[model samples]
Target chain A: MKIKTDKIKKISKSSFTIYGMVIMAYVIMQILVSTGSLSSLMEGLLVPLCIYVILAVSLNLTVGILGELSLGHAGFMCVGAFTGAFFSVATVDLITIPLLRFGIAIILGALAAAVFGIILGIPVLRLRGDYLAIVTLAFGEIIKNFVNVIYIGTDKNGFHFSMKDAVALKLEEGGKVIINGAQGITGTPNDSTFTIGIILIIIILFVILNLVNSRAGRAIMAIRDNRIAAESIGINITKYKLMAFTISASMAGVAGVLYAHNLSTLTALPKNFGYNMSIMILVFVVLGGIGNVGGSIIAAVLLTLLPELLRGLNDYRMLIYAIVLIVMMIFNSSPKAIELREKYSLKRLFTKKTKGEDA
Target chain B: MALLDVKNLGISFGGLRAVDSFHIEVEKGQLYGLIGPNGAGKTTVFNMLTGVYQPGDGKITLDGNDITGKRTIDINRAGIARTFQNIRLFKELTVMDNVKVGLHEHYKYSTIAGILRLPSYYKKEKEMNEKALELLKVFDLDKEKDFLASNLPYGKQRKLEIARALATNPKLLLLDEPAAGMNPNETKELMDTIRFVRDEFDMTILLIEHDMKLVAGICEKLTVLNFGQVLAEGNTAEVLKNPQVITAYLGE
Candidate 1:
């Protein structure tokens, strides 16, 4: 019991440290903004940094913790982005308060993506390893391509969805097209702010961290390690796998909500919601160290900020990024490096402090 | 009634008869052994009893309820917990967490409750920690509760698997070669642990072991299988002395 409490203390302390670091970063950024010390490049990247961090964290749940490689993360993000943007656009006048509208939209985005998650997870999660990865890759592209041709308009009759161009909508006078196919939703309320994004980050962290230490989390990890042993112990394999996959998708949706509101035009672009984007988030999870929550946050922030930070060194930008990626991968995963990390872990400092008091 | 009664349990792997006409009756609080050569289908019978493979024919009764061909998870929930011949610990999970997973069916809390950290989550988790710690102590694994399951030594890993099995609070515990890789000292200690688990937990155990000494040491009843057929069944002393059983083991 005593040792268990110590373990609990260690886990909670790590969670607190992560929370503290994020808050510290938020304060530093706020100060930078107030003092006008931040460049335009950084100011533009603030909300995006939050978006990538959320994406990295959510993908880590699938790729890192759940032990499944998923390439459809950006697709779930796209689902959330479209649904949230559409909600905000449709209710522009109805919801005069931007905060209220965005909040509702975030919830709606999560639900929509969760539904899609269950739909995809049921059939696809049954296939393991590279097969699941391939299927999710296909899904990411399929969603992007399908949303590219989806044109939805709102008129007195009702919502009209068409695969053809906007002209096929045939809207009445004063009626407008909400989703202009590949062009995506426009006039979405610019409701996203750094504070909202940070708040969402904290909420997402709270949910995922708590889930990791819970009974359900144990069951999920057990399934990841050994399916037959897990089954022998009476864990419902399908239920927990779907739970992890669906939750991961919904969190990606929430990240999408933040992303959609930040942009003036939310489109299903190849750049934003494509195969490359999913793999980008996955890179963050992997290079961060799979299953390391704080590592994910750090990797995401550093990787996202690297290109812009090196804007002055245009020719050397990607060269520097690739080198940094290699360094991080080695530090996060190499056995010798792992040993070094453990040797100098923060727990050592904590234990030393306690030992001093004991002496 | 026997705590576990498997009658004529059999399974075929395509054209091959892996196990045929296998039967065992383990009364409450009994230590039973199923001994056979490597290819004698001992593990196959263990698999069928624990629902790892659906029996091609026969009935499995636990207490009084028929549990034949139930899903592995359902069989575990029905009071049958097992360990594998090859250790299948959740290698990544901490040792205590492995046992806590075994306590999953008994403890109740929704995933939402877990994510939200409701009071019930705290209450149930605390209960689980206490119970898991107790099980670990039984196998002298309490000190290593925080270590990863994969990091434990081979002998302790076997004991940890049994500890995990006992956490499910099952009526019957199945151990597959619990002493497979143990040295003599570890095996002797293991015999004590096995007997203690059976007595303390009031567990009815069925084990598959190639070690004749372990088979004769603790198991009160013995069943001998060779080429998918039971060659002998009776009290441990008599079964071990049976000419056919001796011939099967010695290949005479």
Candidate 2:
């Protein structure tokens, strides 16, 4: 007898569609770049675009799927960036192969960020709504300042750490300083390429999509939809919340690693890994349709490129950007638009048509 | 031994004793009713039993196991599952997915198996879907399985909540105000559904309701509370006729 596996099949089918879209977009962009039709600006934007996509998707796991507001997502990213970049820098002389070193760095970076995720999540997850958001916002600022005060140097005597000042380290002969307070990590190997970014995006998408379609994902969503109901139904709230939060943070760390390597010099600045950055990622999730993973990818890519593409507009760029955001928000959520969307949704396209037909 | 027993279950918010020294003992396959006027601590008792609120003083035993002050999820796993007074269906999820959430604990596969979509995960998920569908069919919600929970009609939403709770396979089901806002017809239907559920599952059921007809129709036993204290307890006919219970409902 043929057992009904319709849910699994449906999930796999939608997942395939998302995967196909990502790969198709990547292939088309690759072709354009290889054909020299894409401008250098657009070319440079590719890696950042991929990074933002990962950031948006990961943050969506918390903000959308988990239904918890968090503003410290970039703090996790900062952890990943600095730790991954540091690994790369420290091993630059030790490991000759860039690919292998970067692979190790990415894993280490994700682990570091996940650790921070757990630490912050345990205390902060206990808080709800605006309180959670505020605490996470504070956490981001704390990490930024904490990274600023931290100073690391290396020499034949081994690594030295000092928070007061870099000079207090008293390094041995030929000692090299990696992190200079405020100046951030400089002279790191720029090993991040668009291909690597695409690979990471695919990995992130694979994990997230599979997770969302899985049992744990449903439990997490159940918690999001109705915490009391979820609890009464025997779902372990803390376990699912922490699971999604840590995974979300780890993915953000992966993005951070990609972002760090992509840059010639990386810093834990407010503009780079701060409140504004966190808000931007949140905006991606919101504008994309909360809990809509595929929408997040599109939103991240489009939003990332919008400002760069509007460079010709100069002074009016941000004004136009704000207008577009307002327009998209209205279009995405307005009742009439939603009605139209549901009526013409892709699922409706495939199902047997019954509307407007007599039985 | 009773299938479920509660003694001295009490909680206070500041100076107010919301539920003071409340107690009930329910036998297997019995349909029990907890009735009280608004704010008489009927729902509060359900909250404590389900562990939403830790009773300042009380002991809850299920099948002779102490479950007092346990976390809500642990209490549920320990054979007590409940529904909210207000329907709490996962609004964004499909009706099928909502039921599957209740069946999550029953799936034996590891999370790694789920993420990787191992053969075991598919097998378990298929079983889960079939079981969820079967529960949905029981409530006549099978046809609407793919619809979002929020999109269901108000009456169906209430039914879906009960169906979802039942998916947890609890030995003792605690339903808070299941017939709260239903019309006469819907309430009548709900009464029948509750009866069918008890007979089919052979489970003990505890329900809080202001609907006197529903309470009197199905409950084999009744506990009436007023001012955070039990006003009367006996067979349904006897409790419903108690002077204090009548005064509490009709006022002095």
* Candidate 2 local lDDT, residue A151: 92
What lDDT tens digits, residue by residue, belong to model 2 across residues A205-314?
A: 88888788789999999999988899889888888899999999999999999989998688898988989899889888887878888888888888888777777776
Error of 1 at A96 (Å): 0.4
- The candidate scoring highest on lDDT is 1
True contacts kept of each: 0.70, 0.68
Model 1's alpha-carbon lDDT is 0.88
Model 1 iRMS (Å) reads 6.5
What's the TM-score of every candidate structure?
0.95, 0.95
lDDT, candidate 1, A182-269, per-residue tens: 8899998888889988999999999888888899999999998999999998999989999998999999999999999998898898
TM-score of chain A of 2: 0.93
Best candidate according to DockQ = 2
